[model samples]
Target: MDDKKVKILLGKRIKQLRQSFNFTQFVLGEKIDINQRQVAQIESGHSFPSLSTLVKLAKVYNCEIKDLFNYNHLEKEEKVKENIINIISNLDKKDAQLLYAIVKVIREK
Candidate 1:
């Protein structure tokens, strides 16, 4: 992906993680020792966090720094579908059956 897209995706992933942890931007900023405006900038993709900030964020979120970059769910729907298809195609028969069952359960929900 392009730099802008990567930044946007990373920002979204950070926001998702923050929300999952029940943290507002102000709370997250306090944990990371930044200001709320800075946190807002990061979440809005207008500013990228420094490596130090990332380390602080990982600590605050109780996750590895790499986990903060797991932004595949922020990809375009078509790309996501293609990735899922590729993964499914590589699965063994038994795994495929299990996956199908899981998907069925999810769909029912």
Candidate 2:
């Protein structure tokens, strides 16, 4: 892919990862010590992240660097995860605790 396309692809992958982790760009930028505007630029493909930034992103997303470039259908999965987080968050503490336990059990398997 051309450099522009590559940058956009990276942005999309980063966005998907961010959504899956329920992180706003501002929050992610804070973790990586960059301004949220820079994060927005990166996510919009208006700028490319440096290697160090990429490393930080991979660490924050808990994925291999390669995975960032390989994202496709994962966008749907990320959206689902985002929705689940939003729904679970609105539940009462007792219900949220039960949901968490169920998720943990499912994840452990």
Candidate 3:
């Protein structure tokens, strides 16, 4: 992906993680030792965090730096579907059945 796209995806992933932890931008900023406006800028894709800031963010989120970039869910739908199909095609029969059951349960919810 291009730099801009990557930044946007990273921003989305950060926002997702922050929300999952029930943190507001102000709260997340405090935890990461940044100001609320800085957190807003980062989450809006208007600014990129420095390496040190990334480390602080990872620490606050209780995840590795790599997890901050795990934005596969932000990819194009067609690409996501292709990836899912490829993964499913490679799964063993038992794993496939397990995956099917999990998906069914998720759908029922």
Candidate 4:
């Protein structure tokens, strides 16, 4: 998969996991020292997170680093992809393109 796809998938997983743990954006963001808006941005797949931030998130969620990016079941993968697409579909074209560009860069690396 491409980087954009990765970002979106990561975001979807993060959001779902966060919700599963009954965490609001403010609650999760506080642990990482970011505002709720930032958390929302990350969960919405509008922005990528730094490594340290990702570590903190994984720690807070009680999940391994690999868990944050993994989709083992085909149904789960499709659901997350659908969620990511839904989130991005509402954004303006520029924002969507920016996300896609990030994914492209990641894919190249």
TM-scores for all candidates: the values are 0.69, 0.64, 0.68, 0.65
lDDT leader: 1
How does candidate 1 fare on TM-score?
0.69
Count of clashes, each model: 0, 0, 0, 2
Where is model 4 more than 4 Å wrong at Cα?
74-109
Candidate 3, residue 19: how far the Cα is off, in Å: 0.4
State the local distance difference test value for candidate 3. 0.89
Per residue, candidate 3 scores C-alpha lDDT tens digits across 1-109 of 7988887888888988899999999999988889999988988888899999999988887789998998877776548789999999999999999999999999999
Which of candidates 2 and 3 reaches a greater TM-score? 3
How well does candidate 3 match the true structure in TM-score terms? Answer: 0.68
For residues 1-109, could you state the per-residue lDDT of candidate 4 as single tens digits? 7777777778888888888899899998998888899888888778889999989988998888888887456347688889998999898989989999999999999
Q: Local distance difference test, per candidate?
A: 0.90, 0.85, 0.89, 0.85
Q: Once model 1 is optimally superposed onto the true structure by TM-score, how far is the C-alpha of residue 5 displaced, in angstroms?
A: 0.7
Residues 1-109, candidate 2, lDDT per residue (tens digit)?
Answer: 5898778768878877888899998999998889999998988888999989988888987888788788556546667889988998799999989988998999999
Candidate 3 local Cα displacement, residue 50, angstroms: 0.7
Candidate 4, poorest ten consecutive residues by summed lDDT: 68-77
Cα lDDT tens digits, model 1, 13-96, are 899888999999999999999999999898888889999999999998889999999887678754878999999999999999
Among residues 3 or more apart in sequence or in different chains, the pairs in candidate 2 whose N, CA or C atoms overlap within 3 Å are: none
